[model samples]
Target: MANISMTETVLQCHPMSEKGFVDAIAVHVDRAEGGRLQIKYTLHGLVDGIDFPEVAQPKRTDELWKDTCFELFCGRADDRSYVEFNFAPSGQWAAYAFTGYREGMTELACAPPQIKCTAGEGIFEMTVTVDLPESLRALDVMAGFSAVIADKHGRTAYWALAHPPGKADFHHKDCFALQLEARSAA
Candidate 1:
């Protein structure tokens, strides 16, 4: 078995009625073998209980419409970090990587794949833009893009993607940029 370690940085935007912005940075270390992947992430700048489950829950509101809207927009409460993807060993990629968020509610706005690795440079950079609905914005939606890099022999060299605490105003039709770098296991 081979071990590949990576450093990741993430930025995200949280649109809250009360808190105008919630942005943060996260560092990640990942391990992959036999088509299965495991990741451990540490986040900085997160407010108390800002994970998905806590954010997705509904609060009591005087207005009935407000309460109902929250339920419809945000799904079940979840607290884990949504930052891992597993590619099938058959070499087929999933239409979407991660699951848990509402379907069609969040989408990959822009992802341009630039696959070029220079000699002695283990970094391959790609950019992906995630567009999230207003309700899902509080999930810090920008950290959902991640991929595993494999060599010609189908060995995972590294896993890379941007972490959360992304730029604010992510819902303003602006594109969020993500960079991925793959280093050799030499």
Candidate 2:
């Protein structure tokens, strides 16, 4: 028997002294039966004043980080291996694997994830579901959820689970604040 031990969590943006265009960003993560991880991100505030990209295909795209996009960094503490996932409101997505700190970049082979995005009344929402990698299917994992938001004023801000004491580096170790426990065998 397989066990389902997934919980939905709403994540908050890393606090900073200075405020940006977005008043709030909500990132939610949960695991579904059959080894899938669902991630939803909602941007609330003056969305009309934000500069969001305009793409409609859910196909893989490069350089999405240059604009407004939500991202998740996942890895296990036991090893330096990790994966970076990028989801755009324009329905674009990408996944990359790293052997170590920015070394050996490989485009991960993955099925097209389900994604949806909508915006109205100062709110923008995006949802995506990706299959858990074979390596992480039955092990504890930590993840860092972040977003790059651009404002109508041409200013961009970085949001994450935790921002280290220097520049806004989403890959920093401290950013991995959320943890998911492994499922037990039945």
Candidate 3:
């Protein structure tokens, strides 16, 4: 393959529930050749109070979604299949594959994701890069980026691209906010 050309997308996810804890959440996604994707999240709000889970060993762990974490969903537009990646500030990650909406979920065999995190007075930023699984490497793909934030008082909020009418379902088709096209070789 030729040198991969990268494209960046910036997305602002609105809170699906409580909105008071956050002023804004920005998600940036960059895709390049060979299905390498990088996602960055910046949160501005009362960051100090939130509970960010930390693992003793800083390894991949399930249920990162329960606390403050960033998420990414990617799949072929028509396949009804996708992989969900979760990143936590505590240097933990999780990857899961699904056949359909909330169905046939299984742990995805993926290499460890590269994650970096930093925090300021009222801001927090995190970035993660992962290689898409062979099954999801396609000429075109759809993506949904989201987050779950927990406040100091243990109140949780959901943020997503386009929330479903009834609830916050990032896996829902409506939430696939971005489409990525394969880059041509130079």
- Residue-wise C-alpha lDDT for candidate 3, range 1-186, written one tens digit per residue: 553645454444444477677777887776676778877888888888878776456577999888888888888887888889888888888999999988999999988888888889999889888888877664678888888888888688888766767767788987787787664445
The candidate, 1 or 3, that scores higher on lDDT is 3
Per-residue lDDT over 56-169 for candidate 1, one digit per residue giving the tens place of the 0 to 100 score: 222221222211010001121342222222122121111222243322332323222111111112221222212222233333233332222222332221112322344322
**Worst 10 contiguous positions by lDDT, candidate 3:** 7-16
lDDT of 2: 0.79
Q: Write the per-residue lDDT of candidate 2 for residues 12-127, one digit (tens) a residue.
A: 55555235667778777776455578878888888898888887867999889998899988899877888888888888989988897678889988877788888899888888
Q: What is the lDDT of candidate 3?
A: 0.79
After superposition, the stretches of candidate 3 with alpha carbons farther than 4 Å from their true spots are: 1-16
Q: What global local distance difference test value does model 1 have?
A: 0.25
Tell me the lDDT of model 1 at 1: 40
Worst 10 residues of 1 by lDDT: 65-74
